[model samples]
Every structure is written in C-alpha cells, then in structure tokens.
Target: MAVQDLLRQRFFPHMWCPGCGHGTVLNSLLRAVLELGLSKNEIVMTSGIGCSARISGYVDFHSLHTLHGRALAFATGVKLSKPELTLLVPMGDGDALAIGGNHFIHAARRNIDITAIVMNNRIYGMTGGQFSPLSGIGVKATTAPYSTIDNNFDVVELATAAGATFVARSTTYHARECTELIKKAILHKGFSVVEILSQCPTHFGRKNREGDAGQMLENYKKITAKRGSKALEENPGLIGRGIFVEKEKPEYCQEYEKTIALAMKGAGR
Candidate 1:
C-alpha cells in the first residue's frame, strides 16, 4: 500500500514545531510499516503524552493515545488479548524514560512481542524546554539554565540490560537507517526497541546554540560512529549507532498461553 494510506491527513498541521526531527522518525516508521506489508488493522500503534506521542493521532491504524508514560502498559494489554497483532509504541525521551521508566524496564524484562520506538530529542519539546532524562550532562534547558547536572540515561544500554531481545539506534539524519532498523525490530519475536536521536530545533537547538535543524542533523552525521568503528575506538566517547542486540527468546504471550494450558491440564478439565 502507498505510505499515504497510513496517515490521517486531517491532523496534517501537526503539533510539532517547524524544525522538529520527529517528523522524520514518523515518516520512517510509516515506511517501515508499509514495507512490512502490514494492513492498518493488523498494526496497533500506541503512544503517551509528548510531542512524539502525537503520532498515535496521525496514524490511520488501531491507535491508543494513552496517558503519560503508560503507552507500554496499554500496548501490553492489547498484545495479551490479541497476540497475533503487531504492536508498536512510539514515545519521547521523558515519556519513555522518566515517568514510564518502570514500565519500560519491566516490559523489557518480560520480553513481550512489542516494538517500542524512542524519540530522543534531549529536551522536552512538548511542554517547554526542560532537560529530559536523555539530555546530556551539562546540557542547558529551562530547568537547567546554567547547565544540567543530571547524568543522561543510555536508552540502548538500559533496554539491553533489561532483557530486551532486540535493540537498535539511529538518528534523524539517517533516515534509511531508521527505516531499516525499525523494520528489523518489528520482525523480531521478542521485545524490541529502536532509539532515534531526534533534533529539537526550537528547544535543543536554541539552548545549545546548535544553529538550525539542518545544522543539528549535520552534527548527528559528524558524531555518530558505527558500532565497532575505528573512529569510536579512537574517541571512545562517540555515540555508537547500530543494532546492539538481537537474540531469540520466548515471547511473553506465547509463554502465557503455555501456562494456561498447563493449568487446564492440572485441573483435569
């Protein structure tokens, strides 16, 4: 199907800012869904409260624009009820890592069959310019005018250590990479996460003096090193981008079905 078939154009004038990179991420996701040959009925999209979370309202699929930091919980329920459906949850830095952190880790640990995409724009773009959990140390925000002292959480690392079977990273600058990685994540059996380094030109750009959205994307190209690259080996501080983890695991829904069968047999019914 054409990619335009997946959109709800009535929401055309989106809520995101003029230069926000979430648009690229959304485009990649829609393209990936199309490439996967998933019909709108077969795909379930969920999101929480954030600029990125606004995607749920735009996608012409079974969507749930849920509460703050609760998209995973809602998505999990949906998956348990209809294990055959493809579940996708897209969230922002604060929505996924701050209030939704507990759910994020627990879902990873459960290894449920859901693809969660994180838009890491550093600062909170939706609710004014505050430093998000993914914001770098010393980054300036409305809350941290001088500089932020909070250490940023590494989303890829967190997912890997939480038992996610699939994890990948891409930047808004790398549109092809984002689509390819998300395509892989969707096909994975267990829980999968793809973190996209999105740019917030209004908030992050102005705060860090990173010029315009174009400049921020250029910086992404300059800073991102491929996994196991010689450049990363030499610098040791560069953000490595690639599929960091992919492993076979029993999906949560399938295991739960097995448990139900076992209980029924034990009851002699």
Candidate 2:
C-alpha cells in the first residue's frame, strides 16, 4: 500500500512545528504500517490531548481523539470489543505518563493486545512548555524557570516493570530503527510499549538550550547506543535503543474469552 493511501490527505500541512520530531515519528509509524501490509480498516489509532495526539486526525484509520490521558483507556475498550483489530495509541510524554500514568501502568499490567507509542519530547509542548514527568532534573521549562528538581521516569524500565510483554525505545534521529521497533511492537501479541524520544525544538530545545532540531538529532545519535552494543557496555550513561523485552504471554482478550466460556458453562448455556 502506498503511504499516501494511508493518510487523510485533507489534513495535510500538519500542525507540528517545523523541526519538531513528532512529524518524523508519524512518518516512521506510517511506514511501519505500510510495510506490515495493514489495511486502514484493520487498524485503529487513538490519542489523547497534546501535540502528539493530533496524529489521530491525520491517519485514515479508525481514530479516536479522546480526553487527555485517556487514550489507552478508550483503546482498551475498543480492543476488548473488537479483538481482531490492531490498536495503536500514540501519546505525548505528559499525556501518557503525567495525567495518564495510572492508565499507562494498568494497560501494561493487563497485557492487552495494544501498541502504546510514547512520543517522549520531555515537555508539555502544546501547553506552553511546562515541565513534564519525563522532563528530568535541571531542565528548564515555563513552569520550571529555575530548572526542575524532580527526576524523570525511565520509560523502558517503567513499561517493562509494569508487565508489558513487548518493550522498546528509540529516537527520531534513528528513523529506520524507530520504524523497525514500531513494526515489532505492533506484531507482538500482548501489550507493547515503544518510547520514541522525539524532539520539541520549539519548547524543550529553546528552554534547555539543546540547540536546533538538527543538533538535537545529532545529540540523540551521540547519547544513545544500540542495545547490547560494546559502546553501551563501555559507557553506561548512553540510552540504549532496541527491543528491551519480547516474550510470549497470556493476552487479555483471549483470556477474557476463556472467562466467558467458564461463565457460560456455569450457567448451563
């Protein structure tokens, strides 16, 4: 399928700021979908309120633009009702982990057949650059003019510990790697989480002096190493990119079917 066929062309001239990495993420995601040969009707994309959430509006899939921090919740219901459809929930860092933190963890715990994409730009981009939960200590933002004293959540660790059967991390700088990871995450049978460290050059970049979009992309290249690589072993601070977890597990919807069968037997139906 042509990538253009998967997009809602009427919504082009996307709203994301120039140099924002979210657009790159959108491109990678679409490419992954195309490579997987998924029809528009077979996929569902849900998103919450944020710059990243706007993605649902551009894709020609069954889309749901739900309340802030609730994309996963709505997606859970959709997957439960229609288990055959592929569920894709793309969310901002703050949208997924700040207000939506509870839902994020529980969704992983349930191991439902949903792919949760976290666009981790590390700031609340649409809300005037507030410091988000993923915004690490010493980062400046509108709400943290003196720099944030709070720590950031390690998304890969959080997702893995929360019981997501498939977990991975990548950055916009590594576009091909990001696309491959998304493809793997979507194909995984149980709950999957892929954290893509996107760049918000307008907000996060200016506030933290992270340089322009290109420079930030370069920084990502310098800071991240492929998982299990010798560079990562030598320099522990480098964020590792690649699938962190991929294992078979009891998927929620299939287990739910079993529960229903047991209930029917009990009722002599």
Candidate 3:
C-alpha cells in the first residue's frame, strides 16, 4: 500500500515541533510499513504519553494510546491475545526508559514478538524540557539547570542485555537506514528493539545549545559511525549505528501455546 494510505490525514498539521526529529521518525516508520506491504489490519501500533506517542494518532493502523510508559504492557496483552497481529510500540526516552522502564526490560526479557521503538530525543518534550534517562550527563534540561550529572543508559546495550532477539540503532539523520532497520525488525520473529536517536529541537536543542535542527542532524552524522567501522574503532567517543544483534530464539507467544497444550493434555481435556 502507498504510504499516504497508512496515514490519518485529518490529523495533519502534526503536533510535533517544527524541526523535531520525531517527524522524521514517523516518516521513516510509515515508509517501512509500506515497504513491508503490511495492511492496516495486520498491524497494531501502541504508544505511551509523550511527543513520540503522537505517532499512534497519525497512523491508520489499529492503535492504542495508553498511559505514560505503559505502551509495552498494553501491547504485550494485545500480542498474547491475538498472536496473529503485528505489534509496534513507539515511545520517547522518558516514556520508554524512565517510568516505563520496567515494562521495557521485562518485555525484552520475555522475547515477545513485538517491535519496540525507542525514540530517544533525550528530553521529555511533551511535558516541558525535563531531562530523561537517556539524557547523558552534562546535558542541559529544564530540570537540570546546571546540566545533568546522571549517566545515561546506552539503549543498544540495555536492550541487548535484557535479551532482545533483535536490537538495532539508527538516527533521524540516517532516515533511509532507519526505515530499513524498522522493516527488518518487523520481520524478525522474536522481540525486537530499535532505538532511533531522534532530536527534540525545541527542548533538547535549546537547552543544550545544540544548534538548530539541521545542525543537530549534521552533528549526528559527525558523531556516529557505522557498526564495525574503522572510524568507530579509532574514535571511542563516537556512537555506533546499525544492527547490533539478530538471532533466533523461542518467541513468548509460541512458547505460551506449548505450555497451554501441555496443561490441556495433562488435564485430559
């Protein structure tokens, strides 16, 4: 289907701030869905309260706009009840790694067949410029007037350690690559986590003096190297992008079915 067909056009004049990287992420996600030939009925998108969560409102797919940091929990229920449907849960840094953090780790640990998209813009854009879990130390936010002293969680590492079967990282600057990564994540049969380093020009940029959106995109290009590249080897400070992990594992829903069958047979039902 065409990308436009997947959109809820009446909701146009999107809510995201001008130059916000979340828009790019939405665009990339739409293209990925279209490229995968996924029908609206075949996919379900869930989101928690935040700027990133607004994506659910824009897409025409079956969607659940749930409470702060609970999108994954709601999605887990949906996937378990209806294993035939594809689940996509998109969340902001705070929405994904802060209040919703427990759900995020457990979901990954379960190896459920869900696509978790963490749009790490570093600040809580929807609720003022508050520093988030992914906002590394030294970054400025409204809650961190003197800069944050707290270290940030490396999303790729966190997801990997939590037992996600598919983990990848990309940035809004690498939009086409982000789309490709999302497509692959959707096709993976087990838990998949894709962290997109989205930029929040209004909150994160203004607070940190990170220049305008264009400059922020350029910064992403400068600061990130492809996975396994010599540049990454030479510059330890630079972040690496691209798929970090992909391997087979027993999916939660499928395993649950086996357990149910065993119970039924033992009961002689």
Lowest lDDT sum, 10 consecutive residues, model 3, at 260-269
Residue 89, model 1: Cα distance from true site in angstroms: 0.3
**lDDT per residue, candidate 2, 1-269, as tens digits?**
67888889999989999999999999999999999988889999999999999999999999999999999999999999999999999999999999999999999999999999999999999989999999999999999999999999999999999999999999999999999999999999999999999999999999899999999999999999999999999999999999999999999999999999888885853
On residues 1-269, what C-alpha lDDT tens digit does candidate 1 reach at each position? 78778999888978888878999998999999998888899999999998999999999999999999999999999999999999999999999999899999999999999999999999888788999889979899999999999899999999999999999999999999999999999999999999999999999999999999999999999999999989989988789999999999999999999999988885854
lDDT winner between 1 and 2, please give it: 2
Instruction: Please give the distance, in angstroms, between residue 163's alpha carbon in candidate 2 and its true position after superposition.
Output: 0.5
Candidates 2 and 3 compared by lDDT, better number: 2
Model 3 per-residue lDDT tens digits across residues 1-269: 57778899999989888999999998999999998888889999999998899999999999999999999999999999999999999899999999999999999999999999999999999889999989999998999999999999999999999999999999999999999999999999999999999988898999899999999999999999999999999999999999999999999999999999888885853
Cα lDDT listed for each candidate: 0.94, 0.96, 0.94
Q: After superposition, which runs of candidate 3 have C-alpha atoms over 4 Å from their true positions?
A: 266-269
Candidate 2 lDDT (Cα, 0 to 1): 0.96
Off by over 4 Å in 1: 266-269
The global Cα lDDT (0 to 1) of model 3 is 0.94
- Best of the candidates, lDDT: 2
Q: What is the TM-score of each candidate against the true structure?
A: 0.98, 0.98, 0.98
**Residue 247, candidate 2: C-alpha displacement in angstroms:** 1.1
